[model samples]
Target: MVPWSLWEKLTTAPWLSINAAGQFVQWFNHLLMLIPFGAVIAVALGISLIRRRWWSAVAAVVIPMVAYSLNIWELFIEQLGWWLLIWLISFALCRTATHYLMLSTTCLKIANRCQFFWPLYVGLCSIVIFHPSWLVGVASALIALIPTFICQRLRLFAQLPSKPLEQAQMLGANKAQRMQWVAKRWLTPRLQNWRARTLQQSLLYCAFAGMIGLPGLGQHFYQGLSQGQHAMVGQTILTLLLLQLLLWSIDHAHKEVL
Candidate 1:
């Protein structure tokens, strides 16, 4: 390991230069690290889309609350009820706020970045100060999904034709059955594409999470840059190239499905 003091005096840092195999490994590692994050985001989006509105809001709040509760447990040492109370208050505020903001793009942006507002919340808990954990990634990824739920709900509201419900009623299709069929037909493809993109967004959010003291390449990259380790930063950028390739492939896959 390079000492921080030694790093400061070094004439040149060598890790900046990576070979083809090394680059491949870096990209693969970063992607692998984020796959769980992508999966979590996908599930959260699916639930929000299907459950709709207030339920979706509750799902988004619960994810981070559970995460924060566990982190708090390590600090409070048996105050589960206290932490739960705090989270419930938060959920009430979020629900009321969601009711007002509803469908705006600004609301969407705020939801996806909800944790960004409480970035310091993690720091308040003593357990997270010295340790980095995957729990943070899961919590943050889920927390970031608030905007996705809001956006998907509003998108469905706009896209679903009023004609289908009326026509289905005339055809003797009950409300639940018609909604099931109509929503499936119209929203499946869009949701599939959205899921793929959401995965990418979750990964990017993880990078930002990394900067804010979570464990992963984002933090690693931030630390390297802070220490003036250009080589390490270079590796992180290459990993980003890999992410772009994956995203390109996902986009093409969506088109093919369409």
Candidate 2:
């Protein structure tokens, strides 16, 4: 058992957040890694599911999406064009994947698609791919999305009414049309259900980023631990746990409200 004195430091308050001005900035920085991945998924869904054409969806999704760069502090205009270009490329890739999923007749065909195979191949071949702290952090959050998306498929099967598809078919809607007009609306609500998990994933990645000093609570925790500042570590962890609880409550309330 640890002595009381050994545990004494844990009782002190951490002053890390006392400077209110930088707190929000720090919080946003922590979530930066998650923003692009979220954008990809959101764009893919909005285009392929709702609008039904990946290319047409590009102009709509991309134009409004440039707004994300506005969230970047102090150089919103100067760096906006570069960020827009990055978003454009990322969305194009994601939309291509959406097309693959939309067009594939069989699961086997999707399994054989190039996107999954090649990125994973490149990710594996480049030894340094997983080593960079920034890369790993982003990858962890994106990986967390895998199970969530799978669950969405299962939820869709259970929740979708076959009668609607039959009605759409009788109304002369093609397979793609029915999926776009009917399935898309049904699937959109499922987005809300993922909020809790997304927050959980974001926090997990933030902690991961902290391992390499990526300017988040994770980094703060790492510093506190290295410096033997148990009190600060305690403060940071408890705050994150509280944030997690807050997110869960918010998600639940959102569902209830909807």
Candidate 3:
């Protein structure tokens, strides 16, 4: 049976206090990993406008704003430099690698063959390397996502109609031109979907990294459990649940628009 003190602690523990400041910092860092969410929405809005997809544009803007609110600005302001640095680094790496894979059949084949082994690479880096926890966590999430992103894009390419590409080739379009045309027509419309999936998976991996000593809600929860801090454990669980609910609502709204 649980002690009365445990129940009392749970009831009386303050949600915000000097002692909980570290948890708030960890939460901020965790939310920082979501920079991709904002990037995706911004790009989606642009693409929708260019393509004259009015409903898509409205849904893109309104749904995310309603679901996530303007609190993101607070996160950005709190860690403006760090947030921009991480977003730039991650965006550049992902775009370069993805474009390279899309344009090079040889590289695509290699990535496909070795994609399933990415976990080993992540394990090696996390266990053997001596990087900062935030770096390790972000790197691990990116590494873990490589195969998934590759496979999804490959499937997208395969399912796309080849007639347009063939016609472009027959009209003396260069390889780069053909790739650009395909991206503009087929890929741009779907950037939000892809980025949403990436963000969801990234959050999961980042949280999991907490088990390995990364400073986030997952680490906080782990520590709470280890030290038998029931109040902290409950708070962490509640926070995670709320995060999951937010993701679910976004996905649901996205699907409804589709």
Assess each prediction's global lDDT (C-alpha) against the native. Answer: 0.46, 0.43, 0.51
TM-score of 3: 0.38
lDDT of 2 by residue, 1-258 (tens): 878885675544353346654776777774774464355436444544443444444533443344343332222222222333433554454445445544555742443332223333333333243333344344434554454456545445545544466778888877776766566566655554443333233333233222222234444556677799987666554544433332233233332332
On TM-score, the candidate that comes out on top is 3
User: What is candidate 3's local distance difference test score?
Assistant: 0.51
**What are the C-alpha RMSDs, in order, of all predicted structures?**
18.5, 18.0, 14.4
Candidate 3 lDDT over residue span 112-214, tens digit each = 5554444444444554443334444554555556645664565566444444777888889888778767765765455444433343334333333332322
Question: Which residue runs does candidate 2 get wrong by more than 4 Å?
Answer: 1-92, 106-150, 153-161, 164-218, 230-258
Better of 1 and 2 by lDDT: 1
Q: Judged by lDDT relative to the true structure, which candidate is superior, 2 or 3?
A: 3
Identify the superior model by lDDT, candidate 1 or candidate 3: 3
Per-model TM values vs. the true structure: 0.28, 0.30, 0.38
Q: How close is candidate 2 to the true structure, as a TM-score?
A: 0.30
Runs in model 1 lying further than 4 Å from the true structure:
1-151, 158-161, 164-216, 247-258
Residue pairs that clash (backbone atoms under 3 angstroms), model 2:
210-219
Residue 153 displacement in candidate 2 (angstroms): 5.0
In terms of lDDT, model 1 sits at 0.46
